[model samples]
Target: MNAESIAIVGAGVAGAAAAVRLAERGVAVTLYEAVHEPKPIGAGLLLQPTGQRVLAAMGLLDEALALGIRVDRLFGDTPSGRTVLDMSYRRFHPEAYGLGLQRGALMGLLWRRVRALGVPWACGAAVESFQQDGDGVTLQLAGGRTARHAALILANGSFSRLREGMRVRQSARLFPWGAVWTVLPAPAGFPQIELRQRFRSASQMLGLMPVGKAHAEDVERGINVFWSLPVASLDGWQERIGLQPLKQRMTDLFPEVEPLLAGLTEPVQLREARYADVHMARWHDGRVLAMGDCAHGMSPQLGQGANMALIDAHELSAEVGTGGTGGKDDWPEVFARYTRRRRAHLRFYEQASRGLTPMFQSDAVVAPWLRDRFFGWGGRLPYIHQQSIATLAGYKTGWLWGRLKL
Candidate 1:
């Protein structure tokens, strides 16, 4: 394998994006996946304009736009309509609406495009271990399959098996509160073009985002409804009562979601998730590089997980250019450049997510007070409000770095 060649581990959004970008630059690349047929978990995701820009750069914007709901504003309010957040993409730019998309549809679209790009794929190739030296990186997959590449990309995920061995020993913290989410038919009075979230303090939280018809399943059920609860309480809570109580709680908190909540009469009808923060001192090691959640994963507080992953992939792929077989002499420095280019952007999101999570997902303790005093009002300030909007739209490179035009 020459330096122009890269073998990517994990066929997720990051891996696939990297593969397509590098391939487009006339580089030889292959994407490997642990599963033979990869599928997205049953959930919806918010694709911010920055992510849309990334896809647009990849020539996928039009295709992606067809698969999701277009949300012009992000509105978070208490039951009594006391505003917690009221940020509009139009505040940042006219064309900066967020995309409420079903994860399955996004993944499916990417997979098809990757296949069309003719990049080779090695599926069922679970990379159990890897060894990186000055020459190159070698991966040992399950069932004794082995592969080597001049440069290997670890784009797997937050809990990466390869990241621990290569660089950055990070202890990813699990949030005490996660979310229970599901998709159902949008109620008669549902807003089709906005992400409306209900929040009272922190313990009482619910999100209703309209996810368009991504696939056949979504044709009937298009709104994604989510309820935030303590992660530790799921087991005991489920055993102690039935879904009626949960539905009642959601209905009591956000009556608008009652139409969807009524269908969630069974706990099994929804999925729960606990977010984590994956921190790394740096994001590369010699010819081996980590991208996406493998390098820097943060909570969904900012809703930038997928956008950040797209940025990581695109940045690295751009740096790993369309040159001839460059060899090991140059890649390490190139990887360093990739880190430098991505560091500020990545750090801003991580810091923002950390500061924002407790406000929305915790027990509200002191965070609610802190949030109301700082975030709630600060977001209304002219300058700070725009900055917050830029951050939410995935454009901040640093605190004072100003907005980054994608």
Candidate 2:
């Protein structure tokens, strides 16, 4: 499989990461993107250890670290601002640290690296259809262009069209709530702050993450305000997304945290609330394989989205490098092996993230008290904090890096 040409669909972090890894191995790679230019649509992202390791592996860690903020701890709280849990990224994965950055910034850095690695890419080109023979797969682009490769990696994301041919099943869960956020001016001489999460209810949680140093254009010049809540749908999003409404709501329910809302002068960005899971049952049939959100979508509560995608790239690239001698018949074994190794970790994170909703949203009188007690007790036990951090940080060894020793 030396110098095998591989087609990678989608250019998000997962697709780009895969493309970068394959190209670094001297594999001829062509990346396809439906969008003319990748743009940031989501809010901020926290790169857990898994993601950080992938970036470090690509030699982009220092660059990313410079553009982001490293919070010393993860602090969970109630609407009343009672601290529920406090843990740090280092406690979870001592080898690496977690940092917060805008989704767009991360993509921009990856895009630069992808081009520098010499991976050929076709933007604004949709994959209309694809067919795979025993030897390779041929893809038809939206504008009538075509490309052929020995293998195809579908990192096209959750709503991937390629999943149709793979015959994968998908299920969605709508939490009847959603979130919206806006950036604000950072305070002058403000101290570095930890990421904050406040549970207003089972269907709502607010996260405030410090992404970078304050800029002049950010009004009020204090910090970014991410106000998320559970809503029924888009019908009332405009009203609910208003700064006044959000400010009022926070003032009523979270007086302690409300003072921070005074700095939220920027327009609120409303985001719909929906969750889904992708079950390919088989990741590859013939030369096509799905990774990242295309393979499995988990709630953001765990903040493992980017982390899981990077780990997928790391493992997939390793498999491609080691198992290239294998023919198409070998892919099923490879996919099976990949699935077997990742399924447990993915499920663990999924369940762990899902479990957070109940604890955060429980309106029971005793629930908040219990949650506070749990955090207080956990804080007293540093080892327990470390174990919890490792699990959330996605630092499992052997299965991930193998003997790469990184």
Candidate 3:
């Protein structure tokens, strides 16, 4: 009823963050999520400087800080626990480097902020279809609830039906790998989790992260173990193996990270680790646009999926708050500008992440050895690591809002 009302689909982190930002600027927004209700899912997510900056802008930095553990340094090691490379976070970024937090907690925090801001939301109301008229876009819910908005943002995860109108295509490829992740109670005498990267010659990369706390009543508060094994396929991946085998294989492959895995009581095979990518010629069509994973779903190798979503929300807010590139009537040029601004940065991360995957999964002895040696040398190059962090964190981008001269 006031300002320009925008409808954001999928009230996940991206949608919630965007709604909060827009509401803070005095714009009314309505968020829609297909899920019947938010569920406790997902493990830990790495919050780098890019995400931290967005959280700070939204007054969530302090809260997130309290809920997260500041990783003092990053370590890369062999399966035998030999430290191959190590770098401090403070050395990379002056303000902060990275923090680990449960995805549920992060989403909970954003949801609270969205509700506090009085943004209207419709959950469990999956969109049946949508259409654009001369004035605005009309969204039809599966339950027959109809809504309209001057603009629409499709943040409904990777399988967004609303984004189909934009000609987006999705590819679900089975990486020669799959992963199992679960959280365990941090035993009273549990060993402090050292960020470990277990490099095995078998082309399997296993990682154990300290999730800080577990919400499950049955499980003691503890660490989250992420096992990325080279699976030839993901078909029936979930039933292929169980926690004990995974733990045993990991322990046998990388003894260093084995201690952390051994501490776990059981592993929750929450979701199958299948690599997917969503491609769209453009994320926007007229007043309707897409953001987050719906617009660009990428491999988790970069660990920047959520971070990139935050960035997308931030940039979209900026363009709209600044009057966008067009009036409410015309959004072609506006969407074009948004695409141009984001494509280059997206490609950089995409290429870099994809490049690293093969290296991690390579069975060739000489290749992996050379790859480790390269990383070893890279660790010695101070600027190389800084630059790596900057690029992945989206710090060095000219299009980043803070870096914008205008």
Kindly report the root-mean-square deviation of model 1 from the true structure over all alpha carbons: 2.4
Error (Å) of candidate 3 at residue 294 is 1.4
* Most TM-score-accurate candidate: 1
Query: On a 0 to 1 TM-score scale, where does candidate 3 land against the true structure?
Result: 0.86
Better of 2 and 3 by TM-score: 3
Could you tell me how far off, in angstroms, the CA of residue 363 lies in candidate 2 after the best superposition?
Answer: 8.8
lDDT of residue 30 for candidate 1: 80
Candidate 1 lDDT, 1-406, residue by residue in tens? 3334688999888898888888886668888899987877557889988888889888887877777889888888777667778888898897679998888777877788889989989888898888878777788889997787877888998878688887665666667787778887776766788888888887778888888877744446488888887878765667765677878888888876766665666677778777668888888788888888888877777888888888877777677643345532366777888888887888888888888788888775788766655665777898988988888889998887766556
- Clashes in predicted model 1: 0
- Model 2 weakest lDDT span, ten residues long: 397-406
The lDDT of model 1 is: 0.79
Q: Check candidate 3 and list the clashing pairs.
A: 176-231, 177-231, 185-220, 185-221, 185-222, 186-221, 186-222
Please tell me which predicted candidate would have the highest lDDT against the true structure. 1
**Backbone clashes in each candidate structure, one number apiece?**
0, 15, 7
Q: What TM-score goes with each of the models?
A: 0.93, 0.83, 0.86
Taking all chains together, the TM-score of candidate 1 against the true structure is 0.93
